[model samples]
Target: MGQVDPHRPPWVFDCKLTARTTPNPEKFDEALRQHVGRPGHWIDLEVRGDCSDAELELIRRLAQEADTRPVVVRHVAKLISAGQEEAGHDEPS
Candidate 1:
């Protein structure tokens, strides 16, 4: 882990997902159709900094609406750290 920068704010994280049907192959396409492609179904979302209350609510609703369970999600963010540079601590060649 890197040292946190006192002067900067914590970075926000985001994610986008495209998920298909069930674990079973026979219902895979159908599940995707019902969960992703159908009207009133949500296919993707952007999660920010652990997500906002509204966003979290939407995600929960989407999960229920799609009749799906969330396993894992990938996140992207900018990492910032403040520390002494160690480049100079080296032996002479």
Candidate 2:
């Protein structure tokens, strides 16, 4: 995990969205390519925070008529410690 800087604002997903509509009808797919993978043909589009006006407009349009398709959200993977590893203890039988 990355350390947080006190001066900068914490990462926020205020604009996070899950839309089921495809993006084939949009004209500005290139602008959101980095933010929305496969924007032109994606079945699901997840929008994070901090998007430009143009990008936001496209996202807003997508959200208006989202379909009933299932939404897919990817989560960050994390490693967990059970304390034994840190305390130099092995698994007990």
Q: Give the TM-score comparing model 1 with the true structure, all chains together.
A: 0.24
lDDT of each: 0.45, 0.43
lDDT of 2 by residue, 1-88 (tens): 6888655536532343354444564544444344455334334544443456676555556543353333343222222232112223
List candidate 2 segments past 4 Å from native: 1-49, 67-93
Assess candidate 2 and give its lDDT.
0.43
Task: Give one clash count per candidate, in the order shown.
Answer: 0, 0
Best by lDDT: 1
Best by TM-score: 1
Clashing pairs in model 2, backbone N/Cα/C closer than 3 A:
none
TM-score, cand. 2: 0.21
